[model samples]
Target: MQDLTLVMAQLDPLVGDIPGNAERAIETVREARIEHKADIVVLPELFLTGYPPEDLLLRASMEARLEAARQRMADKVARDVMVIVGYPGRRDGGYYNLAGVLYNGDWLGEYAKQVLPNYQVFDERRYFTPGNRPLVIEHRGARLGVLICEDLWEGRPVHQAREAGADILVTLNASPYHQNKPAERLALFAERAREVQRPLVYVNQIGGQDELVFDGGSLVVDAQGELCVRAPHWQVGLMPVGFTHADGHWVPQAGECEPLAEAEDSLYCALVTGLRDYVNKSGFKGVVLGLSGGIDSALSLAIAVDALGPDRVQAVMMPYHYTADISQEDAAEQARMLGVNYEVMPIVSMVEACNETLAESFAGTPQDTTEENLQSRCRGVLLMAISNKKGLMVLTTGNKSEMAVGYATLYGDMVGGYNALKDVYKTWVYRLAKWRNTQDPVIPERVISRPPSAELAANQQDSDSLPHYDTLDAILERYIEDDMSAEAIIAAGFSEEEVYRVVRLVDRSEYKRRQAPVGVRVTSRGFGRDRRYPIVNGWQPGE
Candidate 1:
């Protein structure tokens, strides 16, 4: 029987680091060949410059950089192994996403990605011209068909490869993470494998890129649509799968099949990976956030600690008159438990000083949210100062539910460089907190059970200005993610008043969200990139 060992290089490449990525590709090929006896190695889509290079693809030097990277790969990689890598190529004066095959220090063949995804965090069409041909190459008595990330999503590409006498289909991907995304990919690819009647090898990248996180769940399915191999998620490594040609078909040998993480576990890991990569890649000394002892901050602290370690995370509790004694106690207890540097800096004097300065301007104004917001602003100023002095990124702790209704103070509690829970709803915050406790028990029990409050004003609870989190999140998800109209949400058992109110608030809060720092996106439809609303518009809440 003819045998082939294929290795999937599930690696993380920093965006725009062409030379470094090329070196990494060369090293991975060498390692695969020496360790796994791999005859063929495949990397993720756009592995040279990382996925979603965005405007970097438009630079004049992009072609030169890519060519340099290609040359380096060719010169350094061993000829005994074949490497299939993804990079942007210019043909006919237009760019195309291409997967090039290299063997014996020469080009074997290349396949241009036929499909370009343009929706929901993908704008490939903006930079790439669609390709029209299929590429299938013969190696070691087996015909290998190559496809890129979006090409496998469509049908014509796979059909063309099969029609071209291909024995196995191989796909390179830089797919991002969202709730249940791994499952969605498996089901879709399993159907594709069965339709084409070929064993499919799928390779995906891992790590965080800006707001996107690519979970490296590289996998393989046999001709009958059976999963035979799966690499671990939220990890970077090289996975090997051996295939033998028998009975006129290439059959994949069983390999490591890592179990998929559960819902809460996956979501929590995504948050941690996103935060860790963002901090390390952005060159920050550490992260510091105002830990108000509420569920949101408590969970944010836990995530930061888990991501960058307690040594790299600092917590500052800025309490005011409205801040309760229990809040301070919980905050301190959690910080101590996590072994992070914790400090308490009261904000009462700072708020009074701000009021004294604005006394003349507010002489006729009755006490309102404006004064309560001052307390938040003072805490923000202190956090930013600490961040600037210590080179730490200020982590904002506002959840999606609060951000949807404008409950978060702009330039106040919203002051930060990154937010770990910006896309997570207030309800999920509690769920994640409880789930994390099962893992390590760092968050205090009272922190998870207590009613969430801003503590900006005396006797003020979040419920005072908004619906309960369960009701609020349900309405928000329907309107924001599902794109349901206000009338439709009302018809779905929500009260008409609450629907209209929440819808209006979401619409008017576009400006605040625009200014908010980018954060890890766990849901299919997050506030960034995916949801784009005009800050100045006359859109009303209606059907």
Candidate 2:
């Protein structure tokens, strides 16, 4: 029977843990062969050293470590099942991202990734020398062509593989998650599969790597562009895919297809996964955040509790003189409902002391955002102190909308190791809060309904400093995400004045965003790695 059973091992690999990841891959492949009768096992791209190892790839010991891993795998791995594993290889006076096949305790062949993606969160070109040729290997009457993540996305690699007489294609990916990315990926994969006219197996890594969360929606597609099997998203598992060769073509057998999560659900899961992996992988004791009784903080608090659970999360309400009674009440209520350690550390005295100490320096100046920033900075100091004392990571609660408009106080509200809502817009913050409530009513309703405020001054709403969130988010999506000009935004029906104002704010705030804490990226254009801009650019849109 010309039937091949491929086991897609969608896994989470910690960066720099070469021996551990090798052991895990070996054991998993062994189990697949013995238990599931898998003919071959496939792991995601750069699984050994982990994807985008960054500067770790430049270390002197990396090649030696990889050589050791290769020797160990060759020694311990059984000969029953063929395994395709990805790792970084140093050859020909350069380093290449490679996928090699190991079978019968022998390294059969290897393929270096051709297209090195350098945009957005990816910087593969900086570290890897792109391979010029396609690699096709034969195993048990099957011609399997190997392609790494970016290789499959570009047309040449797949067409070249087909020309190299490949019967089936196997791709390894460390593709990161952004909102609606899975759907977009599927559409692209289907197009590629149809274009190449070959059955393909796509395996992706699952879990978070700092800001990038890889949702494991590994799948199989037939030559006709039909999706045959889909592994669960944001999950780590080995999904089996069977393919049979008929007359002259390979076709994937019909199998399980997991339904995609809804928009809010997927984004929430990405946040939870990103936060969970960032804390757990970094070896943090837990997480602590100042939970203001507002939508952003409330959503962040809920995500923290969900990511690390109640015992591992601590919510502190740092109230000032201007902080409303309702804000405190809602904050405490949400913390109690979530069953986390809650505290109220009023910053009135801290602010007063700072003012008194700086009175002489600021004697001639009238009170402005400096005083407001002082309040935020006090809260930041307390949060950092608690984090240091307890050895827990501080979780900042600023959203993308605030980060885009220079609304968040740098070294103040932006003081944290991670921000769960960093890529989420303020408008989506409310939607996510409501969605979280559907799962469990941990967030107070009052918090979601209340108009957002920094509570730095009397009756100071977010609208006092910026446009309404709905308007601000819309303009930001167009200007920042879509790269629309101010004139284009005006043409799209937004007021010219508001468009110019929002555009200017987003442009000027690049410096602060450059220093802000890394957060989960749920949008296509997150502040950190996704959107990069110079701090001193003189170009103005519609000028």
Candidate 3:
């Protein structure tokens, strides 16, 4: 029998903030050492440099800076308890998402990831060269095996670790949140534990990176494929797992944890956590958004205020000539109730000036979507101007529903630094708006009750340009996210014409979405790496 104490620190780390994340990880291990007197504190994947660094890993300076931080963290280790932390590793003419064991300024062992997921929101294949070995370390009179985020998912690492006579298996992850993902992870943990017949400890990072939110639902499983310790979903905390040998089988010690949320709430928390960390971690003083008095903007405002305090959020209403008075009132009222700074910038004059410049070429053309798009473009320019002048990032409020149908104007409503609801559907936009107002009156009922519109043209309800959400979302879910063919979607109670039209729109709009800012992905298939289509393909005309 081997005696060992392990601590799983479920932390939310910001992307690209090496020093800040390193400092917090070091502090967490120190505090946990004092509180639990643990032998080892395991941090989540990429804690030192934040998870899903995306393209940030391409820069050589980032690796140098992070190495400096890791060295600093090693110098501060003045206790018997060691730390197994994750970060990027640069060696052998390539980068690897690596993890290591630290004790008193010494690194005992290291492991690079064997599996680099390239599907869905992952782009690891675009970055690192996959590692090809097993890692097991001797510590505390017992043998310990380690794996990075995607390494544990591969069968080779687990089998090799077991072959190497590992007593306990530990893994670090930066897994993203999807609806019902926690449940699926738990099942995988159980199945994997049975295969290895060792106590498995999994620690995941929590926070939002671009359009992906990592839900920090870390957990521990026993040899019998049973969950002994589970961290609460979306919240950051630490859990202690003690392993005991019972009849040559690994048993786990229990502890308190936060409860995991379900479905919509879980998805919402991921967005909030992602937004909170991205804004706070990016070193921005605050956030600014253009509230259109519509559901998408309203929901985005709610998320921003919830993530970053209301004091840090600024809402501006740039109303155009066609913008109704009710729209202005709704946006203003919501901003006031949320206790955020509100500004009403009348864009009628600004838009008129721009239209005057283009009047000659558009003389014979009847008023159409292009003119309506001008209004949106004008508002986007003003918002961007504010973003630059104040050094504040503009949060775009476009939803997946509009992004799919090309209802949003490029360089207009879509011209912000971040898009909070980019992965959320218009139907969910309404649901989230109602759910948020239930928390308080930050959003007006008028925004929810009225017809969905752009307000760029007279009575320009979204319905006039596309199908109703009740119908459109169903078609999209079946045709897009669910990966159904056009004929298959028609079989799912949607009209053939509706299915064909929606699929056509999605195919044609890939170019626009390609340029759109990354958004939090709550669905299985967002308009991101998850669903890649050819923008120049000519197969859409029913060849």
The models' CA-based lDDT, in order, is 0.93, 0.91, 0.82
* Candidate 1: clashing pairs of residues: none
Best by lDDT: 1
What does candidate 3's lDDT look like per residue over 1-543, in tens digits?
Answer: 566788899887777779888889888988888887888899988788787777888886987898789888888865788789998888788788888889878888788888898877788889888887778887766678888767666667887888888878889998888877888888887888899888788898876777778887888888777778888877787788787766755567766645666466776787788778777767787789998888888889999998998988999999877788998889988988889999988888878888899899889988877877888888888888888888788899899888998877899989987788888888888887777766677789999999988887777788887999989998888767877788877776788887888889888888999999877788888888788888898775322
What lDDT, from 0 to 1, does candidate 1 have? 0.93
Q: What's every prediction's RMSD, in angstroms?
A: 0.8, 1.3, 2.5
224 in model 3: Cα distance from truth in Å? 2.7
Error of 2 at 184 (Å): 0.8
TM for every model, in the order presented, reads 0.99, 0.98, 0.92
The digit string of per-residue lDDT tens for model 2 on 134-225 reads 88988878999999999888878999999999999999999999988999999989999999899888999999888889999999989988
TM-score of 1: 0.99
Per-residue lDDT of model 1, residues 131-161, tens digit only: 8989998888889999998888887899899
List the lowest-lDDT window of 10 residues for candidate 1.
449-458
Model 3 misplaced stretches (Cα beyond 4 Å): 1-3, 17-20, 55-70, 90-95, 541-543
**Candidate 1 C-alpha error for residue 423, in Å:** 0.8
Q: Which model is ahead, 2 or 3, in terms of TM-score?
A: 2
Span of 10 residues, lowest total lDDT, candidate 3 = 255-264
